[model samples]
Target chain A: MSIKLTIMDEMARVAREHGKILAPLDDDLALLDCGLDSLGIAVLVARLEDKLGLDPFTTAEEVQFPVTVGDFVKAYEHGAH
Target chain B: MSTALTDAQPLRARLTGATADAVFFDRAARVRVADLVCRTSLCGGRADLGGRAVLLVTASQLTAALALIELDGMVRRLLILPPDVDPDHLGALIAGAEIDAVVTDGTLPPQLAGLPVRVVCTPGIVPLAEPPRACERTEWVLLTSGTTGVPKMVAHSVAGLTAALAPSASAEPVVWGTFYDIRRYGGLQIFLRAVLGGASLVLSSAGEPVAEHLARLARHGVTHLSGTPSHWRRALMSPEIGRIAPRYVRLSGEIADQAILDALRAAFPRADIGHAYASTEAGVVFAVDDGRAGFPARFLNGARNGVEIKIVDGCLRIRSPGAALRYVGGAKTAALHDGDGFVDSGDMVERQGDRYVFVGRQGGIINVGGLKVHPEEVEAVINRHPRVRMSLVRAKRSPFTGALVVADIVLTAPAAAAGNEAELRDDILKLCRGALPRHKVPAAISFVPALAVAATGKLARRGV
Candidate 1:
């Protein structure tokens, strides 16, 4: 799957788990950030690994910027490649 | 006079004993067993105080017996110990204090032989008499700022120490856990609470792995755990605590951050997470809700259990039921309180609502061009970053900032994925710049696999 699709799916999973409306790809992941503290990221990262063969952002540092959903997706896609 | 068995009961039994006068079992059974082993091995040739007095050198069994014997009226007087304590110093103290008899373990230096001293290895050997009259003026001395700088001998009294612990809203049996040695004030409170409140006590083994200690707590059904921020962080990092939840986690002996407190609360949702400010010189003065971490403490508004608090010179002082007494064998210093006898240990405060919050120790504040920077404030920001797991903040001599703040951090395992130390450092610095104020930002950041803590499992102030 493409990195964009993978990122979108992962964000959707987080949104579903947190019971929040999913934001657009270009929107910030504020909905997930509500519950996506460090531990939440660990869960998200694990899900990303299962869906996409390539992992995004070699470390937690890559996912540091959650300012917008698009930024998270771009970062993840860049890392997965 | 009470005999051996009565002195050996569990803390609960002891607390309930006065009313029940029932069978008592000393909770420190291991120490008693060790003493028995020693007696059997030595063929009982050691000095036996029998019913006279026992001197304790450490809070361990050998010394615990001394405490018990003195309490039970088996001994006329008791002497607790500080390791490598000088005999001449103790002799002079006893002479000045006019204490006649001293019962101790047989490990005293030769110079102490002149005094009437009995060596006791077990609490069973010491007989008990009527409890001594509550000292109208008793002092419990704490030797803090040891050797690193001019060591100050701080003195508080039995009444003062007891007065320091404000009553808690929760009456459920208090479960106490700490890495601190009972010799210090922080750990001493746990001992006192367990003994006085008849609470269950789970003593963390010295030098045990944080994972192992958390596992031990689960196995023992511990409900309350207390430690410094470093200790709690380590325990949280352990997979065991993530699975094993306690009812209460208290951070004391140092400052804490919201991130750590939030993490702990999530890990143990049923637990009430809180922190308190205490020192060897001043007993526990204030406590705040778990959410109050990273901020200055909100002092208890109304006196609880006869505890009192006041801020003097921007320093928070407390007088509680569990405060300590005066110093002995060290330079005589004034007690912790002011004229009203309220204990103040030089903790800086910020008034928040009706209650006061502790910002930092007065001497511990770092002046960056007159912009006061508390290391804990900066450290809280550093610890909030996702990459950072644990950190220590201390002031360094800097020509530019006068006293520059430095953050030494231990990155989380995932943070190490950033490739190199430089990458992690940049990430941490960037986070600090974005989250903290310009002045509060750390002047220098050092990344390490772990931060060094003291023997008592507290972050060393120097951040060595």
Candidate 2:
């Protein structure tokens, strides 16, 4: 699976576990509007860290805050380089 | 007047009794207290280790207990060396504590090759031609597990060490057991409880399995049990925990969360469960026995038997005769007390309505963003999960918030194998979400087989 799918799957899983009804996973969908809070985002990052064997937020030099789902996925994809 | 006990008198006078029964035990030997009052030596022949600074590095805690009973007022200073002290720093400890003589189990580590005067302490007694004469006073020097470098050595008078211990409440012979080595402060408190409180004590052996230790405690009819919450958590997880029926259970060295307290209550329905607030430097501050987590606010009332307490900027400060006099050799972080004589315990506390809840230590804070989270605080919430056995919350370096809270948790045996661990994780996370603020809640938790508890019987709060 591409890193984007993996991130999307984990986001859905974490949101489901948190009982948050996530908005449609459009690239332009704002992360805050996806019904996930900081804790959910944290869990998503942690699950990604486990599955991907890396935490882009920790590894990337001065990674920007992801305002949208596409930005979050791009950060991880950029780190994969 | 309390006969055979008061700390003001010499241990030679205190251990004198008509009883022939053994008062201390280990995996190998049993020793009587009153018998030690008479002229004798465990090292064979006469040991001239009196009226001078003495280093007690006995391999066996039983032997250490014996040394303590025999040399209380007979030595100018008695320094207890726990098994975990850095050998490289042994020479420094020797000079810092003014240790001139050594007592050991004949296996002195290479660190002590410099000390010429040595007495080998084994199990059996040697017929003594004459007992070592008593000194005017003996200062008990205990090494505090300092933050870094060589541990700081603190001096305590016999009265100071025993001031927190209550007199024998009754003559009933309740054999005591602890999961602590008799060298550290927590262990020494139990040692003093057994000896001065007029009770038999079964000592813990290092590396012994929880089941085996519990069985041994059962074999000896251990009724009063004491240890840190970490020790008790490990013991409670063992199937053999049911083997021993204790009348009293005590926790110290770490904050006793409501989860462990409630678990202990369920495990031993009839046992009197209590936890105390004490430190290596501050001695014992107080004990709470109401089957509660934090202590009642009333403990802050007027002086209770000369022990004064005040909270200065969220830290608990205690002033008592039981507090250690001063740190020997002026090691860094050895500012033992303020000019007002209050030893500032670095333990942080928060007032919760009518109770004082211990948050965590001053230096143990985990910063998440701009907010502070105590690992113990996060762990206390996670441990409340029904399937959780124990948890260790810690910090993970995070580019997002400088540092993020993470937890390594051990689940109950059944839950571990049930294989629905994902659900348990979600359940635990939900618990954290409910009880904790966003920053204090763990960002993630990893299921672990076990958490490492240090020799100090505390959850080793280091990187996972």
Candidate 3:
């Protein structure tokens, strides 16, 4: 699966587990507006790390915390490359 | 005990008005205090194991307690070994403490096979033909918990251990209970308290279920209870928490945060909630009984004997009469206290408003992007959430930051949280964000069925 799809799927699963629904998985959606809380985001990051076998926060020379869904996907994509 | 050990004086000669109420209870049997006046812990083997460094390894705390009472003024030095000591460190501890005799409960572990003398205690009240007589003042040795390889053995005089315990006035029948094994420092304090007050003590086994333990305590009508915050947190989660409504609830061996204090207050409405600040190396420090989190800043004002406190490099240092006298065995250095006679307790604290609240251990900080995060600080914040039953904040290795703060938490109600994990997680995150610094917030939080509490009744910290 693609990194973006994998991230979105895990986010949805985590939200369901938390008894909440996701707002939307659009690339332009700000992370703060996502149905996930910071703990949910953290759980998503851990899940993505297990699924993708890479952590952009650990691999990339310089990294910034993502502001949007697109930025998170791009960071993972860049680290994978 | 400082006066001098006499042939006529046993340890309990200090307790004057002892009626027939005091007894020690385990799961299997019970021994009354009045019956113990004539009987010896080592019933038959007391003759062979006299006047030497005696290592006591008991299967039951009941035996350990009775043996201590009998061995106080009879032997040269008596080391009470907790059942959970690492076997690898046994050889060194035996040789270092110069253990020539051992008092055990019928069975001896293979590690202690080479000891010169082994006496088996049955926790019975049978009179011995020739009971061990008091000769030398027995120095009591205890082991400090070791995170790495081996624990240090601390030596204390009988005078030192009982310095802070004032004899209980004959007011009401006070039956005591503890989650701690009687061999450890905290539990030993409670044992001494029971002995001093001529009261009964309900002992806890190592791996006993919380419900069964609570039921047993209720059966005994336990009135005074003491344990670590971790023990109380796990106990509060059980439905059997209402079984025994203790008149006094005490917490020690860890920092007592605001959340646990409040929880105990609400659960036991009529009980007086108190958390004592006692160090293993340092003696018993001051206790906070005002239902507050940390002690008042004014506690540091007076330079008294047992209550003296000084903050050197943020670590709380104390000089008290209740501390360990010296380090036994040659495993470590000779100094139990500092040059100024103060035991430097490695707990760090911060002055917030009118109180000095604990942050974390001095060597227990997580360096996250050059910012120090105290695990206890994060744990205190995480526990404030209503959904959290218990939380252990730990450092997870991270290449981005030196170490990332992560938390493993147990839910107060697992069945009630089937689909409501997201809201609870959100509430916890919001609480942490408001209370803790950004770096101190957990990078990841996982809901575990239960957190592993050590044999010391503390939240076990796994390797980072």
What TM-score does prediction 2 earn?
0.92
**DockQ (0 to 1) for model 1:** 0.02
Per-residue alpha-carbon lDDT of model 3 for B1-464, expressed as tens digits? 33256443557454444568777898888988877777666657687766778998888888888888888777888888988898898998988998999998867779888887888887766875654456777788999876777788988877778777877764888899999888988899999899878889999765678999999999999999999999999899888998889999999999999999999999999998999888668867878899999999999998655568899999998888787888877756667678998888999999999999999888789887688989999999998888788899998766446677888899888788888777887688778878876678786778889999898878898765
lDDT of 1 by residue, B409-434 (tens): 88768455556866666668678768
Ranking by TM-score: 2, 3, 1
Ranking by lDDT: 3, 2, 1
Determine the backbone clash count of candidate 3: 3
lDDT of each: 0.56, 0.82, 0.82
Better of 1 and 3 by DockQ: 3
Q: Against the true structure, whose TM-score is highest?
A: 2
TM-score of chain A of each: 0.56, 0.91, 0.86
Give interface RMSD for all predictions: 16.2, 2.7, 5.7
Model 3: DockQ vs. true structure: 0.16
> DockQ, in order, for the candidates?
0.02, 0.40, 0.16
Q: Is the docking of candidate 2 incorrect, acceptable, medium or high quality?
A: acceptable
Error of 2 at A48 (Å): 1.5
TM-score for candidate 3:
0.88
